[model samples]
Target: MIADRARQAAAAAALVGCLLAAHGTAAADAAAGARLSAARCASCHSSTETIHSTVPLLEGQPKAYFIAQWRAFRERKRTAPVMVNLAGELSEKDVADLAEHYAALAPPPAALASGSDTGRALADRLRCAACHGSALRGTHAGAARLAGQKVQYTTWSLQLMRSGTRSHGTAAKPDPLLADLSNAEIESLAAHLASLR
Candidate 1:
């Protein structure tokens, strides 16, 4: 009986040690995430700055969504040639760290200055609401929220669509509305869409 009890005690102690080690590892990951964000992502994506005509703020995004994008970039499923190279350099742990860092950030302000009524009308006509939802919060699966997205990212994505470069499974054709739009219209739409909180 004494020998059996000793074995049980050892097992319990091992379990406790494992639990503590797991907690410590999680804390370390969060710290690493913060550091990585400052080093790699702060230039184009701000956590706390006001929403401007260009950069996109990446705070408070869903962790799964954020990680999925990084994975897609890494896998070349989402083809931003520049992003592909950048994301290729990250390991799974680095991706998790960056996602956690952005997920913990505060979202930026929502004040866009779109200069064209035509672009807004076109967006509405194109049924951008179908997949992106009424407020562009994005569908739960596969779709990304466009509200408060970076203007540069949005415009660049649209340009890619126009060029037959960026191909998402959910998106069918090049955004027909965007295809007909002039450069100015695209810019106005990007700025206005990014302004939505």
Candidate 2:
């Protein structure tokens, strides 16, 4: 299983490289994405910066990553209950517009626990920037933007991924990194990410 994940990660890494070349450095247009979001996703993804624990913050995510996720949802490869049906209804333009809208918004700020020094080091060592970009923001590779994500949500999600109990999408490959963490490590990591500006 570990070998399989390594292979998957390698493939994903290559895909990310290709996407970077293709996308250059273009970020999405917030105005267009916002209009689409208001029309299509305002109910769950409230206009306010506050995000519920179950839902992820979409703002400031990379357009390419957001598009990729929507496509995955549409194809039934990824599995967010709320997203599965909705994704199928979105037109390609809607996907692009929404991506830009979320990407334009800033991540909401949150406080973190002190004394998580080791966790901070671990995050840096993970080289999350390799895919998520230097700012821990989503990049052209379709990585989810992690800066200022809710700590509880991030922690819960990580726990699920590690335990193989939570599924992001049906076809979503498990993150191999999550498989090796202890509970403390996960919490620390979550705290570190949530504290990002």
Candidate 3:
């Protein structure tokens, strides 16, 4: 099972790299992105950490992943009324700038693990590092950072991914890894990920 997942991740990583290259490679202005974030994104997305459990912490997120998410919102491929409205107002440059700025910021502090041994075991069994990196801090492949992420948000995201309502690549396709997960397993994984420093 793990070997199959590793192969899948390798294939996905190559695809993502190709997609990013096709997307574009231009210099972004982080300063401009900082200004835009202060004016437009600071309300819900705090620079320090996630404002709510449901809101994701954007600080120190991978640049490629950030850009992709913003693009998804802008194109309505990922639908959230607020995000779509805000992202729709941004130009491609603005999206790149924001990705640069947020990627350079400090990540949120780690949450207390309490009893996360079980979760850690689960993560190991699932081979989360196949795509999320050994530290689960994301990768150049455009996978979102999972280390120290908000547990509620992670759980919600996993559930959405499982149901094909949200996806890393396409909304129409659900992640096979998450397809058979129960709510308990999802929560355990989220809790474990949230505890990573």
| Top-TM-score structure, candidate number | 3
In the range 1-197, model 1's lDDT, one tens digit per residue, is: 99999999999999999999886535327678888888887766774344443445667665667778888888888775867998998877887787778666655665444435765775687677787778776554546667777777778777777665765445556745456777777777777777666
Q: Give the range of the ten consecutive residues with the poorest summed lDDT in model 3.
A: 106-115
In model 2, pairs of residues that clash are 33-97, 33-101, 60-102, 65-142, 77-171, 78-169, 78-170, 79-169, 79-170
Q: Evaluate all candidate structures by whole-model CA lDDT and list the values in order.
A: 0.69, 0.74, 0.82
Order the candidates by lDDT, highest first — what do you get? 3, 2, 1
Leading candidate by lDDT: 3
After best superposition, candidate 1 residue 147: deviation in angstroms? 1.6
Model 1: lDDT of residue 173: 65
Once fitted onto the true fold, the runs of candidate 2 whose alpha carbons sit more than 4 angstroms away are 1-30, 46-51, 111-115, 164-174
User: Cα lDDT for residue 92, model 3?
Assistant: 86
Give the per-residue lDDT digits (tens) of candidate 3, residues 1-197.
99999999999999999899888766899999999989988666763344566888888789999988888898898888999998888888998899889888866665554437778988998888888899988888798888877788888998998887887553356887778889998899998888886
TM-score of model 1 (CA atoms): 0.64
The clash count for each model shown is 0, 9, 0
Q: Write model 2 residue lDDT over 36-137, tens digit each, in one string.
A: 788778666543334566576676777877888788798887688779999988777678778777777787556443427876887887777776778787
Candidate 3 residue spans exceeding 4 A from truth = 1-26, 47-51, 110-115, 170-172
* True lDDT of residue 189, candidate 3: 90
